[model samples]
Target: MSTTTAVDPTKTSSLRSGRRFGDAIFSALSHSAGIVILLVLIGVTFFLFWGAKDALVADGSEVRGGAGLIAYIGPLIFGTLLSSIIALLIAVPLSIGIALFISHYAPRRLASGLGYVVDLLAAVPSIIFGLWGMQIAGSAVPSFEFLNEYLGFIPLFSGTVTTTGRTMLMIGIVLAIMILPIMTAVNREVFLQTPRLHEEASLALGATRWEMIRQTVIPFGKSGVVSGAMLGLGRALGETMAVAIILSASGGGYSWELLSANTPGTIAGDIALNFPESFGVERSTLFVSGLALFVVTFLVNMFARWIISRRSEFSGAN
Candidate 1:
């Protein structure tokens, strides 16, 4: 004979209800955290706009005819975009090559070690990179002389090379180095995620390793590569210490001479250099510049997202 044991329905129901309550609490907490983050972003944007409204509305004075919003930030915006673009052009290809090497060419141990080394670069302080750019890279690269020698006919490079070598070209090169590690790390992970079956199938079809990478790995990781490039550009655009330290702030206005000592000034650099002495409208102008930068970065990221989405749709179609 066997004795049957009965479960308590009330207790079981209570346990289920308690779990549901706990889940609800956690769900609400997570949602609250997300809302808080959005609120903080909104608050900061409001603060910037509020501070900049005066500067935005200011009319040009007799002394400084082009002293209004567009004049104040036109060069800064140009410099920021120019430098960031230069940095991305230099960094992206190198980053892809380095990432591909680490992900596919290097031995397992070597790959891991190289990856660690690359990542370690990101951990270094921006101040250190600035210092390195000022002291070592500026002198070592000889970009000024090279640009003047080869590309002097071009308007951007047609300038007298400064002995100090604190030109936009130099700043761009330093920014490239600063951004390289991050781009490489991101691309490395993306490349590594390419399906092994796809790679093997490509090889089975008599495709060489390089060919396989071109057809399979690169296609699979195209969006990731673009993302990595965008991330690097974002960092380069907002870089303050590096640009401030590497560039000469003596010139008060913008010039198109990228190789000249008195090159176009960046918003981040200008803000850092002048914020200490700025007051009243001048301070508000800096906020306006910052707001411009925020908008530019936002638009760039949005453009990148749109590109990624289009690529995804195309991939899905195939």
Candidate 2:
């Protein structure tokens, strides 16, 4: 037989009251943090607009680029997007392949070691990458002549071959290496999180290892891969030091010929390279470029979020 002791009303009430109080405090703190972030973002947007107003309304001759605001910023925007896209194109496949090998194909001991090495790469400074690109990758400029001979029909490679080795392509390759670890780490974790049950079921159905991965693992982690790619792109877009150090771009010279020495300036690199010497409307113009970068990064992140939240098989939240 068991005896039940009657609870004291005061004690029970006190316990419930304490829990509610704790919950309220936690909720308030979380809400305040989120609100603070939103407020900071709003403040930054307002500040950029305010600073850029003079340049935006000013005459072309008064501006640094000797062109209107749109014309000045056009090449910066193009270069920024082109560099980031190139990084994305190079990093994504390599990241996915390394992740697949680490998560599925490699021995457990080898996988762990390789993952550590990859993750360690993220800690390497951008300055180090820039130096390497300037000294080593820049030396390979002449080598691109081979590709141009065969691939010159492609518009991207059609321009006058660069002898300086400081073209847009060099910086793009540097950015790709810099962002590689981030995407690889994200992809490896996502691939590892694939449901064991699904993998087993695929295998039980007489699927090969590759088939099991294709049918189960890849589909399950597609959302994560997209998110990771976006994150890497954001870094690539904002990268300044490396681009500033590697690109030999002159003024507002926008060119679609990526392999040429006449590389278009990127917004971040332009701002970094010019901000110290900039004055009056020129400084304001730099602010406008910053604002553009802010918008682009924000939109990319939001789009990635929307994609991840969509009712797709990979999202797992349907």
Candidate 3:
């Protein structure tokens, strides 16, 4: 048989080199976009910190005298953390359960429809939730009167609503509702990403659907779930309108009443309430509060990343 002439290998190399050049150009552009985003963030932080430097200096003197920054942020920090933690406690499990149900328990058609509904809820304006919480949640305050009276033994639930009837519990519930959709959506996505093989293997071994989910799905998605909840918590911590609408400004500091929900206002709510026409020290203080919140949120996210990194080692171990 006559041998045909072989194609020149140099031509193939030249084509690959051209593609590599194009790829390098595209990658450089994409990487530059990320760097620009990072720089923007740094610039914003620097501006805010610079703007608040004077106030921080004022507060710093008190802190140096052994009073600590507590004098400036004690109430705001407490309110922000407390409300966020309560919202987290209520939202995380509910979101996870809803996510699981939608991901695994529901019929495919129903799951798609329900997921759309939940996503719609997420898109609803935070202002609407605030108004609804203020008007509707405030109206429901009387219903919890029994708990207020009996559970008054506990600080949280101890306080009664105003004659107009609104409490901190009302605010926390509003926050919970606002953040639930976020956590649920995140958890659902994570669960959906669970490797099918792991789940199939568990089911093939005569395990119940729930058992398979518990053993194969939830563990795999645990880090993602935590990250989602933490993200939701971050949103709740900085929620301004809803908290402002639901939480009145009267409460100054931590209250012992478990159901009081009325003790202190969150930093975001405080900023919103006070921002307009606020000048000098007050405005500076507000900026500082915002900075503190930013720091806390950043720390939570960092911790979540650390946890997520650890999960890779544990995910397939079982």
Candidate 4:
């Protein structure tokens, strides 16, 4: 038995309008930020291509091995892909293993500590990794000599091992280590995010812990693993300082021999080594090489995305 308080329709309308206005403002800001990022990427790509045009049109210069745009970039492409592939091959499995141990097998406190250590590795500068690769890791691995000795029959391994062991294989190994922390960090987070309910259900069905992970965790995290691997590959592809420091590319071109003293040609390394001395057409050619690398990386990323999207359909991740 109390008097009814009448709600003002105008007040409710104003409140609803205010919320809608706020949401609209937030959404617009987010969309604008994304657009700005996209525009910046496009602008950079355009600049690279524009800078490379002079080199592309010029006749083959004897200085650049009488190689036109295609020839100029071809070996660098091969080197970049080869080194990155090797790094991924070595890093991915180890990263996944480390991630699994941290996510599932380790004590919570220990896992947290280990994760911090792994993250700390990523904070180390690329220059430091390059220095270590040049000074320490290069000499520490005698496996290069061993491989050259025993596996020399294989074309891939057939090469003279340098005193410094600064071979493509060594670069790949160092790149693998450089990328390990990043791959591990991403994979661990993804694995940790695997649905607890699914894991519990698998275990409740009398599955062993390993079996539970195999059935529940791996399936859930497969896409995430691929994503992390691709991220590492991107890093390896663009790595400059380490490759430049560790690689002894002296022949003015790329080499495929993993154990060769000839350092694998990479765009970033090439730019670092030659840009200072480059002039006019030579400088333009360097820009051309950068454009090529940009295209290659872009394509690789697109391919990875396509693969992930296709797999997602079957994996029920969609």
Return model 1's CA RMSD, one decimal: 5.5
In terms of TM-score, which candidate is stronger, 2 or 4?
A: 2
Which stretches in model 1 have alpha-carbon errors above 4 Å? 1-19, 62-66, 137-143, 250-254, 316-318
lDDT order of candidates, best first? 2, 1, 4, 3
User: What would the TM-score be for candidate 1 when compared with the true structure?
Assistant: 0.88
How do the residues 7-61 of candidate 3 rate in per-residue lDDT, one tens digit apiece? 6675654435444778899999999999999999899799889867767887555
Could you report the Cα RMSD, in angstroms, for every candidate shown?
5.5, 4.3, 5.2, 4.8
Residue-level lDDT of model 1, residues 20-89, one tens digit each, is 7788999999999999999998998999999887777766541122456777688789899989998998
Provide the TM-score for each candidate, comma-separated: 0.88, 0.91, 0.86, 0.90
Task: Report the lDDT tens digits of candidate 2 across residue range 194-299.
Answer: 9899999999999999999999888888988998999899999999999999887775366778788777889999999999999999999899889899998988
Error of 2 at 115 (Å): 1.0
Residues 1-318 of candidate 4: C-alpha lDDT, one tens digit per residue: 245566667665543644477889999999999999999999999999888888878888633546567777777888889889989999999999999999999999999999999999988888788888888756655887788789889987886777777777878888999999999999999999998999999999999999999999989998899999989999999999999888877653556678766755788898898999988888889998899889899999999988888866667454
By TM-score, the candidates rank as: 2, 4, 1, 3
Off by over 4 Å in 3: 1-19, 59-69, 159-165, 256-258
Model 1, backbone clash pairs (residues 3+ apart or across chains), number: 0
Q: Cα RMSD for candidate 4?
A: 4.8
In model 2, residue pairs whose N, Cα or C atoms come closer than 3 Å (at least 3 residues apart or on different chains), thus clashing, are none
Q: Indicate which candidate wins on TM-score.
A: 2
lDDT of 3: 0.80
